[model samples]
Target chain A: MLSPGATIGVLGAGQLARMLALAAARLGFKTHVFAPSADEPAFDVCAARTIAAYDDPDALDAFARAVDVVTYEFENVPAATAEFLDARRPVRPNPRALALTQDRLVEKEFVQGLGVETAPFADVPDAGALARAVAKLGRPSILKTRRLGYDGKGQVAIRGGGDLGALFRALGGAPCILEGFIDFVKEVSVVAARGVDGEFHAYDISENQHENHILAETRAPAAILPETAVRAKEIARRIAEAEDYVGVLAVELFLVKSGRSERLIVNEIAPRVHNSGHWTLDGALTSQFEQHVRAIAGWPLGSTARLGRVTMRNLIGDDAERWPEIAAEDGACLHLYGKREIRAGRKMGHVTRIELE
Target chain B: MLSPGATIGVLGAGQLARMLALAAARLGFKTHVFAPSADEPAFDVCAARTIAAYDDPDALDAFARAVDVVTYEFENVPAATAEFLDARRPVRPNPRALALTQDRLVEKEFVQGLGVETAPFADVPDAGALARAVAKLGRPSILKTRRLGYDGKGQVAIRGGGDLGALFRALGGAPCILEGFIDFVKEVSVVAARGVDGEFHAYDISENQHENHILAETRAPAAILPETAVRAKEIARRIAEAEDYVGVLAVELFLVKSGRSERLIVNEIAPRVHNSGHWTLDGALTSQFEQHVRAIAGWPLGSTARLGRVTMRNLIGDDAERWPEIAAEDGACLHLYGKREIRAGRKMGHVTRIELE
Candidate 1:
């Protein structure tokens, strides 16, 4: 196991990486963040940092030599980058897990192969294929690029009387998947971790809300049946075991009401700590970031007991300007990512408010 | 008021400074640490650092230029260094507070002037003064150097008989304060913060236990009468107001049982975060580190609500070697200071265990 004082190399320099670096520091580990950005939020807290492209082998070599283990905040990290680091130092969650989750089509098939339910989907390689898939899946289906999609990007909806050629052109004619939409009553996610010893622990489920296709709010101990919550966590555990994952992974699911019974459909899989689990930072005995660090370091998993009923709100765009107000609010825990520029729809920070049980 | 993106200048690069830097980053503030040590714990998480002795004017000038406000983790910051920085930028908790607390005799006088009770103390500038003070205060007294003493250093306990001249010589002939033993039943401390607007907030009192004159353990909601606790907070507020404090300060008190009534005698004041308040990191809504940052930045103080019953244990020397076991303990929060060498009597890390109420 990597001991305290060991340097951890994180691949991204976004807020997720920032929080991970802080959590690692709490455990006495120094983090070295590697990203191309000259000054990202994560750089402020890390012990060392490298401003270099992911494909630069020389930079990767230096980073590998400096850190005891390598991990990433985002799953879209290049496969070649992970492979190069793995050759010298251990890359946590492994390259195989990254490959499986980076592409939407592969992730869905992997979940289905494990006997988990998913929406009806078809591959659309070109305009002609899109036409056929649309015919099969019916109108009002979402056509999303199989790779490099996040925050409702690289996607378009095929609604009544839309030209297949234009629709395919809108997505740049990239390889894609067309899936029928489910009228889900609620969207929930299970954030879980797996250790090197194969022990698994999962935080309570978080029911999520999206605004402009970006995560806006999350409430833990989601208002769902206990059995449904159990099933959600079980699906996350099965996926982690199948991937042989050794870090925190989040599985987002759509819960639909069917004939007075509840059904959960696996929507997507995130190979890193997801935003839905941010509430765990304040409301759980162990935060998801710390759990990820422990799992990657080959340590035992910590308790996942809930500390309170939690509500987390993301401060997108100008929302973070209210930091003063939020800071004054009684019992409010405000976390602001050090992003100077205020762009529209950008996630600048978040606040977690908890009601003790 | 310092904006979220402003840089905070922290003096002394120890674990207390390390924690303050982390908390500042959470609020989107960058920290520039100034210290003589090259690899102190605070350097691991700060945006920039200066490694120069406190007496170096050039280093102080650069640090002042880089940060919006200046603060220190320890009260021993030299007078000239603080004045140098205060000329260029604001020095928080003010230099007067540091100067007062640095000298035990001066701090006791200040506390007593506010109608707060303190143990009888006499200044000893020479061997002759020591004899007179001993005769008045009686036996079993503590003779501590007036300045630059910590963790039992620079102090000697006097018994029934001893050579007065030898005792003064043993202390290097430095000015001293001889305090009469009060026979305190318990040691409790109040860690609180005051804002620029004269607003004050205090955490629940913590009962402290010391080993070899170093803080070893702390229990929050210290087993004291409710009225005594309220009175303790009142005494702390009076002290902070009298000092015009603008940051976190810890007031150490001696709880002496006075025949069915408990009386608190102000023992000392630390003009920075204290070890006894470390439990707030995991057991309270606002940690002392975070509270200090807010007060120094001119931001509103956060809620001081306690999460549960908390017990904090300091990991001195080899105590940190049990990190693996503590990390695996259910609901235990372990924090290591990342000190490379585990020398005896050195503070290595700490752990907080909470029983939720």
Candidate 2:
């Protein structure tokens, strides 16, 4: 087990890394954030920061030698970077998790292999194969890049009367997956952690809302059936066990309810802290950030007890300009990412309101 | 009012400043820590740090220019240093608070002037005055240095038939004050904040216990009568108003219960965050450190609502080595200062346990 003073090296220095560094500091672990950007948000609060490309061998070697373990804020960490760090020091959640989640087709196949229900998916290697997959899956499905997709990027809807060839060319002829859409009543996620000792703990399910394919809000307890919540957590646990994951991860699921029957379809798995889990910062006994640190450090997992009915809203772009009003609101906890420029669709900060019952 | 991204300059880089900087980061303010030690705890988690003597004019000028406001972690900030920073930028709780609390005689006199009860005190500038004060206050009184006394340092007890001359010489013939000792049933403190807009808020009273004259533990709500708690808060409010203080301050009081009636004596006032308020970090809706940052930033004061029954124990010296066991505890929140060496009685970290009702 890593001692209290051991340093954890974090890849990607965005808001996720910033919050992770803050949580690590609270747990007495120093954080060294390694990012390509000199003005990344996490640098303000970390013990050390290395500004270099992910594939920079010298920088990666020095960062690996300086930290006891390595973790990343984003799932799309370069395969080579993860392998390099893993050889020098333990890279938590493992490179296997990165390889699995980075590709859409691979992630869906892995979830299906675990006996978890996922949307109908078929890999399209080229435009001809895309036409075959489109014939098989039908219009209204989603054509998403197999790799390097985030925040609704690198994906397009296959609506009726659209040219499949044009759409395929628009995605730059990249390998893609056509997923048959599910009419989900709500989108819920299970944010959970698994320790090296094989201990598992999951927070209460969070119901999420997306605006323009960017997460806008999340409410904990999810307003779902207790059994559905249990099943969702079980799916997360199974995924963590199968991956031998050793940090906080989130499993997004589509909840479809009709005529007193409920079904869950596995949507995606985030191998790092999810924006939906942000509500746990104010509403749970132990936050997911702190839980990830604890898991990576080989410490015992903390209680995932929910403290209240909580809602977290992402302050995108100009939404953060109202921080003064939010901070003045009773029971509202405001967190601002130290980003100087505010552009539309950029996540500037977040605010969480918790109502104790 | 200072905006979210404004910088907060903190004096002293011990655990208090470390925590203050952490809180400032949470509120979206960057912190620049100024201290004489290169290895101070706050250096690990600040945006900028200047390692120089308090009176270094060039460093102080640069630090003042870099930050929007200045605050300190300790009360003994040299009056000259406070004055220098105050001239360049606003210093919260104001320099008058530093001058008042740094001297025991002045603090007691000021409290008394506000019609608040304090232990009867008399200034003893010399041996003859010490004898006269002892005669007036009687035996078993305490003679403490007028300036720079902390953690039971620079003080002696005047008992029945002891050498007053020796005790006087032991204190290096410094300016002292003789205070009549009160036979109190308990020691309690009110940790409170006054915003720049003159708004006052106080956390629930905390009952404290000392070991070797250093704070050992603190429990919130203090197991005191409701009226006593109200009166204690009122005293704190009065003191803050009298001093025109801004930022969090702590008022330590002696509670003496006689039959159905209770009396409170102002013992001392801490111009910065107090050890007694550490429980608020996990047990209150808003932590003392965060509250101090809000006050100093000219922002709205956060709620002081207690979340649960809370107990905080200081991990002194070797006590922090049991961090592994502490981290494994079900509901304990552990915080360790990044101090390299641990000496006996030196605070290394703290653990807080909250029992929800």
Candidate 3:
């Protein structure tokens, strides 16, 4: 087991990394945040920071030597960067999990191959394949890039009137995947952790809402049936075991209701802490960030029991200006990202309101 | 009112400041830790740090200009240093509070002046005064230095057999106060905060246990009667108002029971976060550290409602080596100060166990 003074190296210095570093500190571990941007939010709270590109070998080597273990806040960590760090130190949740989640097609295939249900998807490498995949998936489908896509970026929806070749050309002809949209009742996620010894623990399911393709809010316990919640956790456990994943991973699922039966279809798998699981920070016995740190450090996972009925609202853009008002609210836990600018659509902070049962 | 992105200048670089900085970061405030030690624990997590002597005017000037407000983790902050910062920026809890709490004689006088009960105390300016004070207070009384005393340091008990002159000389003949020891049922503390507007709030009282004069453990709600709890809170409120305190302050009290009535005698005042209130970090709606940040920022006080029945145990010296075991225990929240060395009696970290009620 990793000792108290062990340092954990984190990639992608954003709000997630910031929270992770705070959690690491709580667990008696120091954090070294490495990111390309100098204006990283995580740098403000971490013990050490390296403002360098992920692909810089010398920087990566030094960081690996400095830290006992490596983890990332974002899934899109470069494959070569993961390998380089893995060679020097244990890269938690493993590089295979990162490689699987970085590509839309591969992630879906991997999930489905594990006997888990996922939205029907097909690879669309070029216009010819796009035309074929569009016919197979039908209308109102999402054509997302196989790599480097997030928050409604690098993707286009195919509706009634849109030329297949033109739509393909608009995306810069990047390797893509076409997925059929699922008619779902609600979006839910399972935030779980797997230890090196294969001990799996999942928090109460979280029901999520999105605005403009970005997470807007989350509510814990998900308002889902107990059996469905159990099934969601099982799905998460199966995936973690299959990938030999260590650290917290969030599986976004679409809860579909058909007559008297409700089923779930996997939407996406985040190889790191997900926005939907932000509610866990205040609503659960142990936060997802802390759980991730424990898993990466080879420590025993903490309790994932829900604290109460909780709602987490993201403070996007200028919403952070209301921080004072939010802080004044009873039972409201406001967490700001410490970002200097409040640009439109930026995730500036989050507020969690918890009501004990 | 201080805005979200403002910087908070903290004096002292111990675990209390480390936890305070962590709490400030949660509220989007950057912390600038100013202390005399380069290897201070708070330096690891703060946004900026300055190492300089407390009496250094140039360093103080630069630090005061950089932060929006000033606060300290320890009450022993030099009166001159507090004055220096107070002149440049507002010092929450104010310099008057520092002056009052730094000297035991002044602290008792201030508390008694507020219609609060305190142990009978007499000033001992010299050996002659010490002998007179001891004669008045009687045997088994405590002769404590008026300033710079903590964790059982700078104090000696006058038992049945001891040379009064030798005891006086042992403390370097410093200005001292002889306090008659009270026969008490329990040692309890009220950790509270007062905002700039004079709005006061107090957490549930915590019953504390000390080993070798250093806090060992604390349990919240104090096992006191409901009426006594109300009375304790009232005492805290009165003291905060009297001092015009604008941050978290801890009032240690001796719960003395007589027949059918229970009364309290003020022990000492910590003009900053107290170790006894550490349970609030995981047990209350808002932690004492966060409450301190809120109060100093001129923000609304957070809810002080306890989340559960909580116990906080300080991990002193080599006790921190049990971090792995503590982290594995269910419902235990481990927090470690990033100190490398584990000298005997040094506080390394703390663990809080909360049982939801």
Ranking by DockQ: 1, 3, 2
Clashing pairs in 1: none
- Candidate 1 on A119-229: residue-level lDDT in tens? 989988888899889889898889999999999999999889978899899998899999987889989999999999999999999999999999999999899999999
Question: Candidate 3: which stretches are off by over 4 Å?
Answer: none
Ranking by lDDT: 1, 2, 3
lDDT for A187 in candidate 1 is 96
Model 1, chain B: what is the TM-score?
0.99
Pairs clashing within candidate 3: none
Error of 1 at B304 (Å): 0.4
Give the 10-residue window scoring lowest on summed lDDT in candidate 1 chain B: B107-116
User: Candidate 1 at A77: error in angstroms?
Assistant: 0.6
Regions of candidate 1 where Cα sits further than 4 Å from its true position: none
Q: What is the C-alpha lDDT of each candidate?
A: 0.93, 0.93, 0.92
TM-score of chain A of each: 0.99, 0.99, 0.98
Name the 10 consecutive residues with the lowest summed lDDT in model 1 chain A. Answer: A321-330
* Pairs clashing within candidate 2: none
Model 2 misplaced regions, further than 4 Å: none
